[model samples]
Target: MRNFVVSFVIIFLGFTLAIVYHNNNKNNMVKAFAITLSLLKPTDDKSVILINSTIISDFFKKYPDLKKYKSDVSALYKNRNYKSIWYDRKGVIEFASLLYSKANLLNEEGIESNLAYKDKIDGIFGKKSTDKLSPTDTELQLSSLYIFYSKKVFQGIDTKKIRETGWFLPRKNLSYKNLLDSLLINPQLLSKNEKQLFGQYYKLREALKKYRLIEKNGDWNPITTDLLPKEYKLGDSSKTIGQIRQRLAVIGDLKQNSKSNLYDKELMAGVLNYKKRNSMKMDYSINSMLIQRMNTPIEKHIKAIIVNMERCRWIAPEMTKADEYIIINVPSFKLIFKRNSKKELDSDVFVGETMNETVIISSNVTQIVFSPYWNVPNSIIENELIPAISREKNYLEAHNMEWKNGKIRQKPGKKNALGLVKFIFPNADGIYLHDTPSKSLFQSEYRAYSHGCINMSKAKELALLLLKDNPDWPIERIDNAMKGEKETVCILKKKIPIHIVYFTAWANDSGEISFYNDVYERDSRLAELLISDDSK
Candidate 1:
């Protein structure tokens, strides 16, 4: 970080001096370039400023005509106002030095700001969500963001905040520093790169206002114990406020096991429930985790939300005013179908299990295959099928599936592995919508249990919606496809957009957030890295 910062300052100052010298003279491009080279040559700070004598003569030699590109560089350097500009930059740094009393500064991919805060800058100390971001934070974040972008992700003007559908595969040890270093080395410029870069330097200070790059490393541990009390009790009305504080610290059994003990069972229960709902254990033990959650001043949560808001910005906007669209939240184990701005179908879904936790991916539903054949995944083939086949040769025929390319292929029938139907969505994640035979598995709270395909409980409804635009032909056609001897595909009248996302915390239309368990354990991991010691 120090090396990069030093190099950046030198490069910026070098260009400023060069342009100033040439503006006063007719032809001093080489001299200006040479002066910048000299700045790079010496390690001493005084030596750099010593070149002023050479610059003055060079400037007089070439006058105003050469100064055309001056303002484009640094305003002060361009207008011959270096002293003022230098002082301004110096003052800003000094202000930061005094302000940073003791804050954590970390940069881990898994780190995230506290999820329950919004800072109170000028306003009264209270909770509030603002419209925009911090100009300083945005400016600070851009340097790392662009560096990461140039290296790791493909460059493109995502129409809007978009999801990186499907699981991300790594080429090496996946660490925060490793990723940042990779991005710094890989300089990928997104479309419309020129304007974005040239203008960023001018508004660098202000841009920080638009983003929440700095998050409170407040006290909250998602994985640890952070239970809230469900009830509380009071008996001595004469106790002073200070006395109550001292007594409260020692009172452990909030339930009031005995009549003499002043306790609130209900309050303890409610608090425990809140903790459980937010992914904490239900033990009602306010350990380090609970302490952390309490200290997470509201300002922090707001910032975390804004950073995530950028993810949405990367996606191009879209409208689904027509027929219903299906959204399967991979992390939440739920599927939603909406129409006319209202939810028509919502159901629990069983996704890939622990060992087979589903990968994040997306695609459009082109068609639904009724009474479909199930071509088993290779994992199942090697692990389950081979063992069964070794035990009994007739096992393969009893299931109606045949061997193809060393795979256990189940034929379309009542006993087919795909259950009764399969929804195909062409996606890079190799994921799709389908039905499952293990219906009982849906009852489990932990629903990651597939070979990556989403097992939909309302497969029939989704199928009908897919073909809602089709005239005349309807659900009966789908019934016939099942009865027919050959496996059939019901083509949709039009292609439908299917978004498979992984949002663990999101507000509904009422602006009240409903958080689900992070079954994939992604939330805690992301939160940690995002809140590393690099920036607290």
Candidate 2:
């Protein structure tokens, strides 16, 4: 009787164990199927039926790095009545995918700063991400992402810091809250929101893509300088010529690399195009300096492209709306005059040297002074004139300068430092565009010789363009005023907007990009600030 009772207990325990194992397997299968179903569904509006408001606060508490956007996230949800914008019952929404892709491409947008909580954000889309985030967590993640992208790409670095980067252009005032609302409604504007950015930003972004590809391919090989001669002219042949040809083809200056050692016509054409784009003297001769410029690492070019893209973000789209405007790119040493969105004139210009950097500011050209007297600034007089006077007692008399009310001023004449014309725009910096007596300076490839003012190579042409339509100032009268007999001022009937900007890299809509020398050495400074706090 005891043996039979033991056998019965053992059989019952084995049967119970089998049932428990079967149930556990069935439960896991059900959980996996539920996750799959959530992903397959088109849209489940009820998933966010009513998220708990405390979840928003809890999420931020857990991810304090994103806390800066907490208010924005909260306000966004409140505007949506706490419904999940980034999701429905079907898991993350389709729009969420687009936002995710854009966030991952911040570098393409010229932003070095990474989104806070990047790993968690990545986990939301990971293969194991399904069923990981509650609806509220996913919602908050995307809201913060939108704000981060909008602020960094559309608005740029913080206001105070951007100002510190020496950019004084009017910044675009974007409302991320309102922008989110529009994006949610249309979704396509997320990609086509050119109205929110300066027109040039898109151009630079395209250049960045090309340069990054070049960098990835490792096409930029520094030429073997010691092996080559000092210069190569037409018909000259060397291994260095082949290297330069390869470089030019890589950058689209040449149609293709003939891989020839001879400096033929094809290579000369490429060299001329390269020189024009690089702000170099347009010549066919390949010199050591030109080869050195060609040898600049592709990485530096990429950085320059990225740096200029940041500059584009700081500009307002409306700044380009004016029918007539003037843009003086300091690094390019060129001034552009546009009327009705067409190029009216393009002229060479010389800006301040490193010691006296020209101020980057925008104002209206309200006045023009013909044969303007040069009222030398106190700084110049103390730093330059006093020493000259000590060397030569009659220096002021010889230079056509005299004391006026205890201040020395150069009299208006052919030899006056300000030449025959000047364009004035009101600003505290006292910087303006004017003519220079030294016409030969503009011929130089690198022309930073002024003292905090722009020396226009075509000042007379610009003055004539500005006064052409005015009946009061005819061609002959304008000509007479520019003869240096006396100073004459013309108040403009319509004020033309002038923006003096600094950009080492500039691009056009036609897919052409030009890299100029960093005259003020501002690119590295701005680049450092861009990546300084990215780890945080």
Candidate 3:
């Protein structure tokens, strides 16, 4: 009986301990599950809320005022898989801060967009607010900001508006969504060196800043000379010479402010550099024209810089992708042949006059015609040739011109208007690059003497360079063809792309900025368009 009682008590104690342990384990598991569920639950705070397509649609519906950017916003969100891009668990990501700062400085980028809801953005960032924002408002506002920035920085004015401004250069079509994707991946792209604008645009912008600083410093004092001579040459001595030295120093043409009252060799060197930059006759003489150019107001220079930056926005970035290409800057009156983005040839070119401005377009040069006939356009025939023929009965024989097929044509000879060669790139404007017989005109300071075509100063050199690699056209054969009386046509194996552009201000490879006269009076028109729209 004693043994049975002891065994029964021990078994009861063991069963009770087992029950207690199982209950404790069950309670602990229930507590752990409750904590995990709390963590997984969506909260109004300390969590990034997703913005799906339906949410975006509802948000736009509530705020119909932002409907204009609905498509762009939707596209952006779709690209991001309907996730919160500008927010995190703490709200408003770091890039939002960077973007807001950049948008506020739009003017520095030559953009004129009035950032909408700028005050709200400033308030959001200024307070570093941790308060939960309505996800709808957050997504919409951030998307709007992205669109505004991309449009201003990546794409300039609308394509139609740019075309209306008479710029026909191929405009780069960019996808804002792609740009945003890049920024989301790497926010440091907001840096000036990594900006979305072209490399040349930034150089011009830097120049703009420098010029504005000069203007703010009251610019240079005007050059006033009591004894204004016909020309001031090297080794001249006068008070005007001192003023010239100071002026050159102010504009950075001279290394130091000599403060001398004599035109020494040092000052002459500065004058030569200045004249070269200004596309003037590079001589040691300082004339009235050069003085006038120097005295041009700093305000005008600033305007020119801003205007050309706008022009840069219209250029396609892919233009430099070609293996070989030609560029004719109309305002500079220069032609550049580039191979692998390196300048192969630079030539002086005479573009059309103001009344007959050269068309801004791109075409491919297909053929080179040596000793070509000039099929005079009807306008020139009726206006010039007929009148000349009436004045001189032997005008046709005297000028090596003849009447053929009821149209006037100049024969292929020394007296031909198109000297010894012509480059043909067929376009609707009836323009081509040709050599001119009146070479004296090229030496003039301003060479806008063409009727609507370009006159090349180094036509023979251009021909040799273009055909140097061709196995068929040797140097001797090219010369013989150019000297031949019959018209000889040689088609190129690879067509060279040519772009005729007009820029009143541009930067060189060394980032030196040059400003030219608005020879066609097109700056004012473009400026008017730019200023008229608050969003540019």
Alpha-carbon TM-score of each model against the true structure: 0.49, 0.87, 0.88
Ten residues in a row with the worst lDDT in model 1? Answer: 98-107
Please list the C-alpha lDDT of all candidates, in the order they appear: 0.47, 0.84, 0.79
Q: Quick one: best TM-score, which candidate?
A: 3
lDDT (Cα, 0-100) at 116 in candidate 3:
55
Give the higher-lDDT candidate: 1 or 2: 2
Q: Give residue 116's error in model 1 in angstroms.
A: 27
lDDT of 1 by residue, 1-536 (tens): 43675697688766666676668663565566675566555453212231233443344244343232222222223244322111132222222221111111111211222211113221111225363334332222222222233222222222221222233321112223333233334423222222222222112212222223333332222222213342223322212212222222222213232222232444445446445444444564434544455445335444344233333323323323446567777756788888766887886787876677676544567877888878787878889988998999898897787988766678887666576778887866566687777788766656777877789777777776666667755778876776525688777756666767666554443233334555666554444433341133
Candidate 2 error regions (>4 Å) = 1-55, 75-84, 88-91, 129-131, 226-228
lDDT of 3 by residue, 1-536 (tens): 43565576566555655665677777755555565455454554322665777888887786676677789889877876666677776767888888888988887877666765555455666654545357657757877888877766766667887777667777776777777777878887765523456667778888888877777787577886645576888777888788889888877788898799888999989998888877888788888888888888787888888778887777766676689999898888889998887888998999888777788889899999999999999999998889989999999988888889999898898668888899999788999998988888878878898998999889999899889899899998998998849899999998999999888888776756777878888888777777875542
lDDT of 2 by residue, 387-419 (tens): 999999999999999999989999999999889
The 10 consecutive residues of candidate 2 with the worst lDDT sum are 40-49
Say which candidate scores most in lDDT: 2
lDDT of 1: 0.47
